[model samples]
Target: MLSDQIKTKCTLPHSLYRAQQIKDFEGEAAALAGITLYSLMERAGQACYDVFNTHFPDARQVLILSGKGNNGGDGYIFAALAKNAGLSVQLCQMGVPDDLSGDALLACSAWQAKQGVVEGIEQADFEKADIIVDALLGTGLSGALRPEYQRLIYKITASGKPVLSVDLPSGLNADTGAVSDVAVKADATITFVGLKQGLFTGRAIDHCGQIYFSGLGITKQFDSLCSSSVTRISYQDLSDRLTPRSRTSHKGFFGKTLILGGNLGMPGAVRLAGEAALRTGSGLVKVLTRQENQLAVIAGRPELMVADFDLNKIDDSAIRDWATNLVIGPGLGKDNWAKMLLDFVLASDLPTVVDADGLNLLVDKPAWKDTWILTPHPGEAAHLLGCSISKVEDNRFSAVRNLQHSFGGVVILKGAGTLICDGKQTYLANVGNPGMASGGMGDVLSGIIGGLLAQDLNLQQAATLAVCIHGQAADLAAQQDERGLLASDLFPYIRKLVNP
Candidate 1:
């Protein structure tokens, strides 16, 4: 078994926290460390300025959109530094600068003292600016945008200016990844203190572009003091866990994977899953699809052992006996044929990756087992939870944890930030792209988990590693262009990551 070889614990580089959690962490830590708000504000601005200079060093003119609160405070600090550095800075105060207090007022005064006049929007020249800094709102944003902020945000967006947002893109919910009526679409975002939970998932990904982190000299303290809601998974963390196979290793050392799905008209689904299973290093892969689909599936990927389930000539006992692990789903529709095949697989004691229609069927039966991994997209999760898709999406972290509890196994909630939860721990995958939105993607994911399971990876290891592998492959494949990416395009990359 490869259980000893696989790493179940994730040492996340940056754990994700909610807006309030981060605030509390910063406040308590700053108090203990004797770090003043004024100095921290300076550090935030300094760190952001460094990253900005490295990225847009050639630019001479900058636009800083300042709002209320400490977010606006950071912008003022940045503008002061920029002006001092000989960059022409255009600072627009969305709110009156006189209203700013404490560190914010101090920052504004420093900028003014530097002869950097904070301009009104009417006086600001958008076309003259080389880069725009979004500081209209921060992690405190919720609900719809205020009318005045909306107009200003739209103006910046329409300018097609490369924007570097402060902390977060304004109007984005730092806790839920939900976007209000409007949010800043920045070219890059420099988040300070802690990595907000929202930045990695949902609509936040669309707004917070090319995310950069600046702990502002408080990263270690923040980590030690706060409990992160989710742990991010990366290939770098998992690479050393698997060493190169022994030269004398035999095929029998790896286990057999059985893939059952692809109802009559959907052979391609099963074929894609089966081929992916083979590519991911499963010792053997057999597809038990519909009778008519078997020949085409075999023709396309002959490495797979295709046994037509509907064909009475194939013995059920033999098919079940051949599998060391089972993958049930893909195009396994809700028809009688699919139900029959799924029931058989469900009855077996084999470890399984259940996805697509399998998850749909699971909604009705509502069973649980520690050995099964349930991969459900938002829609399927909604069905299982007996709620709206919006409800499932409104809180994906909660939904996945609930699924793990209800399913009594590993639950892989598939979406933007794919979440995997064994009863004991929850993991988030950061490797996928939007291009993975197309059809047959989940089928491939099911195959990967099942393939890893067949290799004797423990339930959590198999689910977590397979999720990362599936996402990493999709990301790699989408490099050419995510728009036209296909599920099969991930095959080569999937093979590469599994081996690495």
Candidate 2:
């Protein structure tokens, strides 16, 4: 059974580190806290047991998989504790017990002294266990998993039983969040010391069901040893940026946003973007689209000013002059008309947001502009970088940085864990859910960023805050159900998020 805490969202720390960083400095941190390595291992084991007891107390049978490293040692200590608590515990060993050394050997001996039984992988009973504990590997693991380990991981996943992983799930890359081949699909993971950057992004979201963090009483000391590789931001961290508007302020005080898109057959994308812009507190929003899309763009949202864009009219000076910030390429098709409009938008000095077809169009004519923000999903990002989608998703941190370095602006790599990089620093927004797979979601995000940009927020601030707001809105809208969620469903929640 899943715990109530598992269903509820967990608050995460802002700073995130790579596995190597934590491993390199953990000993120093322990010394600073006046604790030995074995003591730290004991704390890690105790923390894992506490989480298991709190989250899965109803379970009477516990199966623990232990390896030969420190992670396995944590499991041994947990097994001893569970046995002492009068719970039925089965400790399965993946490697020879004599191979263990250091704190791990000590832990194994302690468990044996407690009259614990260790079984081989072949003797383990998956059906009899209420919950499985994964302690097969630690942060030091990289590259492909051993064939035996892979077999065990596959078997564990197939068991359909709840799993509690100590540190990160086995076979998961702690630095990049990339799985080489197979990884344990843990129901809940208790990460120790510092939070691993890999646990928040990429394939980690699918493999790690729920994440729980334990500093193990050395968080401050550990954090003081090294700087974080990335920073995590959410709605609560950025909501203060949207302060209450001055009572005397007029419509023009918030600035105007000009959105360009909505090709002949697709008007919904542009409409969603325009409405999202307005809902996000843009003082005014104007849409310049095809003549056929004019009515569709303004049908229900009469507040939006829609105009017919004359493709024959080469001069767009007047339209360009109207917007304080620009959002281009929601439903834009990659025809000559799109190219012309894109070129026109690029020629201007306006701070702009480029998304959807705009990103697709950029593949042909790549130009670096510091004033624009480029938002791209994996496919579009792979196109922009001339690489496979797998390559981009494999190491999203590297891809986002490369995109920002090449594009010379803020780059938002949209996915399960959205990454925003501005060349200087990178931020990860751990909000949003599977429901965001619906169409027009990207358009909504682009418009939200444009709206905030028009309201005088800098490029980084606008991108970060808009992303969190957009994701938080989606989460709220998906509260009742994530399936069948539409982009338009986020409007009311978006309004509330921005006001916060």
Candidate 3:
């Protein structure tokens, strides 16, 4: 039976490294768990063979593309196994076999004694194979794709055969998930040792068509290493955080949430936010919208207490008396009236969850920065930080950290792997999917965080729970229909997850 630690270690949270790193990390741990690293490698090769056979059992004529690393060593081992299994195996070297050293060379010698070998890859040979094992240029790649490897990648991409990449799809940045000019587009990528974060996001999603992970039976060793606090939250886990209610519980137990947004023509922003706050279990929800939106606020959702007029209509004294914890900047336009209201809300003593246009206005004023959670997408974060989108993408860890330092509060940088950085610590949420790249997603997330805040969670706790639950809900919804999953798809599920 696989232990939970081993099951978890099968998917690495970081990038790929030299097989030696895998060996060093897993060797001692596997021994303590009553296994060996070499034994793990053998199991890895066997897993690859099993996957290949299960997926393409009739592909008797096989082409094993080997590099000069242990990844290639894995390929050589599998090639020998395939040959023994009565398949016509051809060992094609992207680099010369003579250049292979260490375990890779040992595996190569074993293959040479059995299967036929070739020094160079041929286009005709590639066309003739029913299946191709892409072991070329595994994890140690950096900078750009090598020219020779680039050409091979292009050819393999054009081949249209079943290509199973060993470890990561070569030429892709393992840590950042960035792909250079060329990368092998594989049918299935069987990643061993650990699942690199790159495999699920950015260009990786396209290059790696199907992802399969194998622990190679050394999970306990890898888990022993210290890890970043970041994790992918699923619905099952999020639901566990919900405080089960007793029949004796009353509304007074939950705190009030004040939603301050909805400029002149955008009352719907606060409308949705207020409703979401109520839905998320805030005892009382209030909406401070433009006076013109008073009727709409009351008509759209009568359950909320709508504060009349813009923020300017009410003095700091009045604003202070109204809200407990505030949520600002959902559909807040950049008009002067909206700006003044935003300033008043920012200057207020209440803890705030800043989102949408509120963040835009805060970036402009540059004052009101302490214990406020600033939520922004890549473009918005770039604007606030005054950097290009590429710079932010190049290093998200730095970008999020910079935001928290400048703003003096928790920062939720929303994107593929949404980052919640609280100045000292950082958490990466890997729950969401591509289908969630639509409008109104941030709006919902802001409201969720606001509700948590109203429920008396600290700024950091509110942000963490809100972001995790949001992504977790999206992940759960995706299980039903990944292609059609939307931001609103998480609404009902979010309520269930938070209140379970």
Point to the candidate with the largest TM-score.
2
- Candidate topping lDDT: 2
TM-score of each: 0.91, 0.97, 0.87
Q: Rate the local accuracy (lDDT) of all candidates.
A: 0.83, 0.90, 0.74
Model 3: how far is 453 from its true place, Å?
Answer: 1.9
Report the lDDT of model 3 for residue 114: 72
Tell me the tens digit of each residue's lDDT in model 2 across 1-500: 32322212456678888888988999999999999999989888888888897778788899999988999999999998899989999999997789789999999999888777888877789999999999989685878999999999999999999999999999999988899989999988988888888998999998887788777778889888889758999889899999898889998999999999898898899899999999999999999889898888889688999987787774767887788999999989999889988998889889999999999999999999999999999999999999999999999999999999998889999998899999988899998999999999999999899899989999999999999999999999999799999999999999999887
- Encode model 1's per-residue lDDT on 186-296: one tens digit a residue: 888888888788887777778887777777666667778998758788767665555688899887877899998998699999999998888888889999888788889
Candidate 3 whole-model C-alpha lDDT, 0 to 1: 0.74
TM-score of structure candidate 1: 0.91
Instruction: Provide the clashing-pair count of each candidate structure.
Output: 0, 0, 3
| Model 2 quality (TM-score) | 0.97
Query: How high is the lDDT of residue 46 in model 2?
Result: 85
- Pairs with backbone N, CA or C atoms under 3 Å apart (clashes), candidate 2: none
For residue 362, give model 2's deviation from the true position in Å.
Answer: 0.9
- Model 1 regions more than 4 Å off: 1-12, 121-123, 310-318
Q: Evaluate model 2: give its lDDT.
A: 0.90
Candidate 3 per-residue lDDT, tens place, 386-433, comes to 999877876666788888888888999888777778877776666678
For each candidate in turn, give its C-alpha RMSD to the true structure in angstroms. Answer: 5.2, 2.2, 3.6
